[model samples]
Target: MANIFTSSIGKKLIMSISGLFLILFLLVHLLANSAYLFGPEAFDLIIVIMGSPVVVAMVPVLAAGFAVHIAYALILNRMNMKARGAQRYEITHKGEADSWASKNMLILGLIVLGFLVFHLSHFWAKMQLPEFTGGHAENVNDLMHLTFGNPYIFVCYIVWFVALWFHLTHGFWSALQTIGMNNTKWISRLKGLSYIYATIVCGGFIVIAVTAFLRANGYIG
Candidate 1:
């Protein structure tokens, strides 16, 4: 166990597991947020269900998973930087076949993380935080409209989604590959699956954002 924490492969394995966990969580989150498409009543019902004891119990677990993933990612990135030393840029260019996201995972991750803080301020702080603290939660649809309705915020979210899409494109298959799915037979298949999964998840969020913006501005409902 101690060796696992200290070894390179061990750290990667941990990162892979945590990344997969977050990927699963993202799908669940997307499904929950999709309820907004049905109507405010449906969205609120999903929110109420999310506030139930079972989901509430998992909040700390989710937080810990995010912490572990972010911490390990930073550690591995720093190690790679040191290993590359002055050759970092040159080495990055050498991987011509590598996806852009593969070469710049750290940058994409930082962008996603930065926007995530802004997102939490707009939504989670108003809804989850208040509910957790026994205060009245805001109307989910109203807040969604108000936040996504802003042209600036809407544009920022689109940027965030784009970054997230790139990040996921590489991270998804890489995580699986690290977890012993590196056989030639599986390699291409995994990459294909990664693209599909990333497209669906990010695409869903983009659609939701556009819908909220339109509804908020009286363009549609």
Candidate 2:
């Protein structure tokens, strides 16, 4: 088991599995967050359930998965850089077609990670940790209104979502390909599937954030 994780193939396998887990978690999280679009009452109820002991227990698990994913990303990127050495800049594929996101996954992932920290400070710290640490209870709707009410924060979130979309577009298919779904016949199909999946997930998040921002600005009902 230890040797498997230490090997390159094993690390890739771990990353693949962990990536899938995070994707699933994102879908569930997006669903929960989308409830906010229904209004404060519905959203608050969903938050209540999410804050329950069982859900709270899963927080560490989620955090661990995120940590592992980021760690592997850093390790793999450094290895690639070292292996490529001076040729990294000179090497270019002439006849190959690659998506913009495919070429810049690491950069996009870093942007997403940075925004995630900002997001956690604004929402998770105020809501979840407050209860655990005996601080004042955070009202879900109030937090949403306050956070999205700021034009700066709203723009920041929009930028984050854009990076997330790019990251997911490539990461989705790559995860599958890593797990042995890379047959010539299935490659194109998986790429298409990746785009669709990325669009839905990222689109859902962007809609919720933009809707809240619009509502806060009185631009929408």
Candidate number achieving the greatest TM-score relative to the actual structure: 1
lDDT of 1 by residue, 83-172 (tens): 755544314222313677888889999999999989888888888898778998888889998999899999999999999999898888
Model 2 clashing residue pairs (backbone): none
Q: What lDDT is obtained when candidate 2 is compared to the true structure?
A: 0.82
> How many clashes in each structure?
0, 0
lDDT of each: 0.87, 0.82
Residue 4 CA displacement from its true place in model 2, Å: 2.1
Q: Highest lDDT among the candidates is held by which one?
A: 1
Clashing pairs in 1: none
Segments in model 1 whose C-alpha atoms lie over 4 Å from true places: 84-97
Error of 2 at 184 (Å): 1.2
CA shift at 97, candidate 2, in angstroms?
6.5
Least lDDT summed over 10 consecutive residues: which range in candidate 1? Answer: 88-97
Return the TM-score for candidate 1, rounded to 2 decimals. Answer: 0.93
